[model samples]
Target: MIRIEPRQSSSALMTYGIPVLSAIISLLLASIPLTFSGAPIGASYFEMFKGVFGSKFAFSEMLTRATPLIFTGLAVALAFRARLWNIGAEGQLYLGAMAAVAVGTGVFDVPGVILIPMIMVMGCVAGATGMAVPTLLKTKFGADEVVTTLLLNFIILIFLQYMLEGPFKDPMGLGWPQSSPILDQGMLPPLMDRMRIHSGLIIALICAITAQFMLARSVWGLKLRAIGENPSAARHAGIRVNRTLMSAAIISGALAGMAGVSEVAGLKGYLTSDLSPGFGYTGIVVAMLAGLSPLGVVAAAIFIASVFVGADSMSRAMGVSSYLADLVVSTSLLCVLVGGFVARFKFVRLIQKKEVTQ
Candidate 1:
């Protein structure tokens, strides 16, 4: 018979090293398919590497793709850390995008300074509103937040599709579902001329830094952490668990909302059904892999973004399917989950000796 024993908290090395190791594993797994597909696996890998990290332009694209993930990952990480199941980031993203579209289309005459902030604020408000339903149901009716939130994702997706296909559809385009291009005033200013990279990257970095500061050095952070560890204890300590959870949900929703705004105002320049490249869902993996740390989320975002950029190049250069990249990302997330569990709780064999006489 085998016995299990609890392991000690993980070391710093284990915490950081697991993700790197998992990346190597994911890459190896990805390579197997490339070889089988009659592709030059080595050259494909080289192309991917170069596509993401070789030139300034390639690096900029990586950062551009990472901007939204950073916010979405932070959103998931913050809520999860607070023990709040906020699986509706996708819906929240949609709400934000919708709100941005409203601002962009209806208030095109506003000055840039005013328009940009107005769009972002509206997006955040919409995201909070989208989160309200699940939060209220969880708090009042004892509904499972996970189920409610997940269901809401589909609801919001359908809503977005309807709007894009009906009311928001551009009149000039021949019925292809899409919104009018966001007004120039509301569009995110370019971070570098002629690059798709925008101020959204700066916003993501700021949000990450602020989240890190909040979690590490604020009174609210202490209460959140306490509640996350033990809600009963937190209540006994006079830290209102319900209130803290609600606040966390709002923050999470707002972060996801910012991702929507970034995608619309910074990248797409309009709201569309495919606004997100599943960034909201991918955020869960990023948050888990990062151990829910803000700094770690930044690193994870970059890692995932690099893989995506590399995958595009791999497809073009070696005729490999980009879907393989998604597989690798999913596999990496699974490995990280297992690694974290092992690092946090180890199993050791326990032996028992009994006297022969007994």
Candidate 2:
């Protein structure tokens, strides 16, 4: 009989190695599509590498793109750690971007020093509001947060379209549905002269560090972990499961909201319908690939961003669609999930010989 057995010891190396292995497998699978498309696979991959890290500027750009990814990845990771599936980060991102625009342009007229921080706060608040719906339903009404959070994504997308077409659309944009330009003071300080890199990258890194600290050293984090493992047991132990979940959900939303603000205020200098390019959705993949580790999420975010930045060059040089980047991310994530099954459970088959005797 064929059987599957768990490893005798769950090594940290194996825990981390899965992502690397899955990435290799994903790359191999991606090549099949490129081959079918009659593309020069080697040159395409080479161009992708060059585009993401060939030069100092390219690496800087990759970091810039990774900022929001890290934030959203952390958002998903934090919630998942609490055993809460927060799938509305995409909607939260849009809401946060919208709030940043409103506060940046409508209520601010200070120097960059003041305006940037204020806009960031606004964005975080907006994101928290988006998350509150699911949290409230789960905590108060005993509804399933996963379903509500997932459905809210579509609702938020519709709201984004409505705002872009009606209230926020710039009249001088030649009928393009885009927001008015943000005030000059609202733009994030560039990390270096002549680079699109911004302080947002620093913010993401710091946030990741903070999350690591909390999860590793804080009492609150212990309570969260307990609740995640067994809510009934946690409650019996006086952990206050509902409160822990609420806090985690709010924190997750705030992080995702910051991601939206970073993209709008730091990169685009204004809100737009395409503010995210699905960064929040991409973050879910990042969280899964990282095994819900905050530190792992940071590394995963950078790797995913590399794929995106590289795909652009691949497309230009090899005439392939950049959307293939998404395929890389999706495939790797699936492999990660499949690889985890071995860590969590064992499978075995039993043999029977009674039929011949009968």
Candidate 3:
């Protein structure tokens, strides 16, 4: 007979080591698909690395891709830390982008100093409102937040589509499904002379640092961790579990909303239905890869961004499908999940003997 047993204490080394090991294993597994596709596994990987880090332009583009991921990853990380399965970050991101578009398209004619902050705040508010429904459903009606949030994502996507095809559609775009271009004042200024990287990167870094500080040094963070570990025990200890969870949900949503804002104001300069290439969904993987650490999220996001950017280069150079990047990412996520499980528990063969007294 075989039995699964939880370890009394998990190894600290394994806890951190699993992510790296999983990544390596994922790469090895990914080589199978590469071979089947008639691509040189080693060469493909080499090209990917060279594309991401070999040139200044490539590095800048990678940073731009990492920017929004940082926000989305932080959003997922914060909620997961509180044991809240907030899966509506995708919806929240779209709503945020919508709000930013509304504000950036001369909803107000303020200067950049005022307009920029206004757009960001509006985006954050929109995101928070999107999450409010799921939070309330879970807190007041005993509904599952996971279902509510995930469903909300589809709903928001449809809503965004409706807006873009109707009220927010740009007449100058020749019937394209996109919003009007953001005015200069509402746009994020580029960080470099030639690169498209913008101030959003700074904002993402600041948010990550702030989140890390809150999680590590604040009383509220302590309460949140306590609640995540055991809500019943936390309630018995006089903690307001519902309120804290609600706060977490709102903050998480707000962070995700910022990702949308960053994309519209910093990169595309306009809102579109396809502004995100599944950044919100990918963020769950990023957060997990970071072990839910806010600071670690930065590194994880950069690494993920590099994979996608490099994959694009590889595809262009080696006649491979760009979907290979998605495959590797998905495989890495699976490896991380399995590695975490193995790290936490062990399987043992149980020896049994017939009862002699019978």
lDDT of all predictions: 0.88, 0.88, 0.91
Reference-based TM-score, model 2 = 0.93
> What's the residue-level lDDT of 80 in candidate 2?
92
Q: What RMSD does each model have against the real structure?
A: 1.9, 2.9, 2.4
Worst ten in a row by lDDT for model 2: 349-358
- 188, model 1: CA deviation in Å? 0.9
Q: Which residue pairs overlap in candidate 2's backbone?
A: none
Please list the residue runs of candidate 1 whose C-alpha ends up more than 4 Å from where it truly belongs after superposition.
1-3, 347-358
lDDT per residue, candidate 2, 94-152, as tens digits? Answer: 88889888878756688888888898898998898888779989889988988998899
* Candidate 1 lDDT tens digits, 1-358: 5655566667888889888888778888887878878888789889999989889999999999999899889989998998888888888999999999988875567888999999999999888877777888888899999999999999999999999988788887677899988888789999998899999999999999999999999999899899889999999999988888888888899999999999999998978788887898889888987889998999999999999998998788778888877887898898888787767776766677875994
The lDDT of model 3 is: 0.91
Residue 287 error, candidate 1, Å: 0.6
lDDT for position 248 in model 3: 91
Hey, what RMSD does candidate 2 come out at? 2.9
